[model samples]
Target: MERSTPISRRPKAVALTFDDGPDQIWTPRILDVLADYRIHATFMCVGKAVQRNPQMLRRIKDEGHIIGNHTWDHPNLTQLPLSDVQTQVLRTTEEIDRVAGVKTRLFRPPYGDLNDDIVRKVTSLDHEILLWDIDSWDWKGLTGPQVAKNILGHVRDGSIVLQHCAGPTETVKGTLEALPYIIEVLSESGFTFSTIPQLLHLSAYR
Candidate 1:
């Protein structure tokens, strides 16, 4: 009789991805909080930030977080030329590779916006496109309670959440303050945090 492979069992995991970062102020604080909770996240970084603070990029990689492409300048990708779109993704990926020694195959378009032209260029470069199922509106003027509520309200099995490392106004503080409670409630409800790659592995598209 042939022996069947024992399936590796894993929990229902959710992905938490941050965009427009490696910010000198907030990214480090967010990293510390994630480390304290022993959770991992995916950071979609801008190429210019990577170029300016290679060390922060290195720290992000070293801390076991997944890195992804978020373009050189945060813009509406649907409005940009194909060549410009290609340059944005490729340059960011290359910069991350140069500093972190890891070439990313994942990308999240800025503003969750993409057009056919952008799509063609992204696929041509062989990067997987990431879109969120849940947006916490941390980029807007939502309070910490609102942020936490938005996340907890929409979170579900295999849900991908959109948060940020750049807080929009002086009062927002990057929404890092909401993370602990979010993680706590989610974990209590039997949710496990995973990076985008891990989430993809469990997704039907994979």
Candidate 2:
């Protein structure tokens, strides 16, 4: 879905977003798990990765998942000049649009570090900035139980979950191991997943 109705007009929901994909190995595996549940998640893709693997980008879109820009290179936007920040976001959006035949309306800053300048630039592009309500810490060397515990501990209505598809070797290992349990717990708890844009409607846009 491109956008969700206003939150007051919509049912309670959460979003699970993965950043820095579509990775050859990790992204596909992640997609499989989400598909098994018939759930949709959003992928914030790096532009160069999308360029290198257009087919994977198509697959993400074809499977009913939304794509968002995470930049051409996953850089700390707070450290870059305004021009660089604009380039990072815009380039990724163009790459995603080219492969998916859709222009994504959401963007997540790499590292979740958004300064006012970067926010203004991203907003100027007409993309909403996505911040997480739940930080699973899958990027940390936490075991499956730990990751599951971390998420379930904080999950609530309209939560946005942060997970990683790209990271240090250790971080990626933790994410892969923890994912199944995380999905199962949230699914059992009567929560449904959607993309960032889908989670943020008029009533919940704050």
Candidate 3:
């Protein structure tokens, strides 16, 4: 399936996004890899993870990547009350602001699970909801090469590719291993990596 973003109209552009991060160990490693390629990716961070490693959140910002809210915890917002859903989003947005001094306008629902209520609440808070068209499925115990294959197979111009920076040990390892090849192949194909805000031409922070 082809997914188009407003900014993706540029030829050969794609957004790379990592979910559930600011992890103490893996986040730094992922940053290093991105740095080596001179590319920036968006990180959708859990509020609890950001609180546990605020410095990592700052580092992500300092390094010129975008940080987005992934919720205070990894809850299925579609299953929660509207009030609880609001709390989940706002708390994380506040935590991100408290740590990085910027308010993010991007949100990715946990597990890509959402309903009308979750969308209404997130929209009311002035956030654009982001979901991926190309899933690397690194969380599924695939090898790095396999994950890379999956991503390359499905990606197109204006595609948002999903990978996890924090998860089980194997997931992190596979993502790390797959990233270089993913970058190399995509870059050689004339695809440039972009953050979500950059891709959508939206404000990264309020």
TM-score of each: 0.89, 0.88, 0.95
lDDT of each: 0.79, 0.76, 0.88
- The order by descending lDDT is 3, 1, 2
Name every residue pair that clashes in candidate 2.
Answer: none
lDDT of 1 by residue, 1-206 (tens): 11111222245788888888887888898889899999999998898988988899999888999888889988788888788888898888888888888888887888778777777789788887877778888877677788899889876677888888754554347377788888899989989998877867632111
CA lDDT, candidate 1, residue 51? 90
What is the C-alpha lDDT profile of model 3 across 71-187, one tens digit per residue? 999998888899999899899999999999989889988888887778888999998888888888888889999999999998777889888988889888999999999999999
Model 1 misplaced stretches (Cα beyond 4 Å): 1-11, 167-174, 202-206
Which clashing pairs does model 1 show? none
- Which one wins by TM-score: 1 or 3? 3
Best by TM-score: 3
**RMSD, one per candidate, in order:** 7.5, 4.8, 2.0
Kindly report which residue stretches of model 2 are placed more than 4 angstroms away from their true locations once superposed: 1-12, 202-206
The CA lDDT at 130 in model 3 is: 86
